[model samples]
Target: MPCWFTLTCAVLSIFAFVCVLGSEVNVQRKNLLGLGSLQSVAVSGRLICLGRPAADVKVKLYESEVLLDSKLDEGRTDSNGVFRLSGSKREFTTIDPKLNVYHKCNYNGLCDKKFSIRILVDYVSSGSEAEKTFDIGTLNLANEYSGQTTDCIN
Candidate 1:
């Protein structure tokens, strides 16, 4: 009976130690700066296709002009034409950093339509993260047509 009591006490002490260790690990993760430190941000937008709500359209996100996080990382939109990208946010600002997205149609030589999406990048200052929405403003996305030029005889 004495041996059993000692073993039980030992087990309890181990469990307590594990709990304390877990709490410390969580604290460390939260302290990490940059994108990892961010919790989440709301990305809502309207699907624009032919100057209208292009329902079921895919949205994407980029970091430093390169693709980092995408709309697929979050989820798809609904019949209401609303989509969101939620995940660990990062500092994004005119002075903080820059992110760009390439509209698929704009890359092809056949399409001449301009497509653009809004990206919201959060900036962490001191201990708080501030949210900023980049409209990408107005863009005249052009299609690169690589072909021979035609000449007519007079």
Candidate 2:
């Protein structure tokens, strides 16, 4: 049908494939011991600039405007333009948090739309509590256009 629909279907197919083959992928981290209740979670992603990989960009994770974790030392991306951050994985019963990605607009002064994204974090358990790793993915960002201005002042 349409290009967007075709693209979406392709992406969904890829995701399905990954899910089916997920068990084949090996994890680098070892299982933790001496388990305890859930604590926090981890958030990670890559930053891009001008459709090119950007490095040394800070990604902040927050909980209702309150600073939870900051990746100052983890800063920057690699040649592949990928960055990652890890936090304590909490239980799903607990209230989840939202994370915000901030960056300068590469469009120069062409548009005022801020180049940023918001990701919702939820609990996805693996093995035991002690030997657990939070999984974060499916992050997609949308760009806002300043050209649209229709508001009733009244």
Candidate 3:
């Protein structure tokens, strides 16, 4: 083959190899963004009281029987009382997710005493998917409060 033809062939081969490698890298990136083999858990619900949505209620998740703040995931209900809390772990082991809700149903001006409701969810795992979403359903704060202790905010 002529020298010019040989050089052109080499350059084309290099370009094709680079294109394939770039596509593989893009796929790996998507997997890292929760589209691959990681395990995940999602908890979502609505806080309702007096037949209406309760907004600004503090919701938190913790490991069953563990109350350390460092391991807690927290969020507040939106204006429509809808909240979603999610977490993921690299391991495939199951986890017991607990939810603690704090709210003042019928009081005004940040009542000195807030009511709390604790929910102990069943053990859940992500299976073989990258992530799984679990819906805990709507929580009626007014009926479930039970006048529990007020340490949820602290």
Candidate 4:
């Protein structure tokens, strides 16, 4: 074989290998973005009042002062006063997260007002590709509401 033909064949082989490798890498990246590297947040805690668990209370999670979608980002305390809220999104972004607890532990049904508590959670995400779980520990509802007073408190 001529020297030029041999060199051409070798170069073609390298080019083909590089193309195949590049395509494979692209496919793997797509798969990761589609299913593997999704960002999720899990928030869990317990509601307590007067040394007892407060059951059936509504728990809400907010990001940047906006309420998260209720269908997937809110929960109610169980019989043990434990609640868990989870949310997932495609892109990883830093969030200012807050927890709100609503219950009628203060007054009877006649008051038509419920006690509310707001907790500012320090969850500064590094914007990495990993699931995050925050255990906010137990929230005591026995104390006075420290959050802003709204018209709901009539």
Name the best candidate (by TM-score).
Answer: 3
lDDT of 4: 0.61
Location of the lowest summed lDDT over 10 successive residues in candidate 1: 145-154
- Best by lDDT, which number? 3
lDDT of 4 by residue, 117-144 (tens): 3333344333342255677788777666
lDDT, each prediction = 0.41, 0.43, 0.63, 0.61
Ranking by TM-score: 3, 4, 2, 1
Q: Count the backbone clashes (under 3 Å) in each candidate.
A: 1, 9, 0, 0
State which candidate, 1 or 4, has the greater TM-score.
4
Clashing pairs in 1: 47-54
Q: List the candidate 3 regions with Cα displacement exceeding 4 Å.
A: 1-39, 65-72, 89-93, 107-123, 126-130, 145-147
Q: After superposition, how far is residue 63 of candidate 2 from its true place, in Å?
A: 2.7
lDDT of 3 by residue, 1-154 (tens): 9999999999999999999999877765775675654444567789888889999888776544334432346898999999987654432234455566777775444433354334333434454332445566786766645556545234
- Candidate 2 matches the true fold with a TM-score of 0.41
User: Model 1 segments beyond 4 Å from truth?
Assistant: 1-36, 62-72, 89-154
lDDT of 1: 0.41
Model 4 stretches with alpha carbons more than 4 Å out: 1-39, 65-72, 90-93, 109-130, 148-154
Higher-lDDT candidate of 1 and 2: 2
TM-score of 3: 0.53
Point out the higher-scoring one by lDDT: 1 or 4: 4
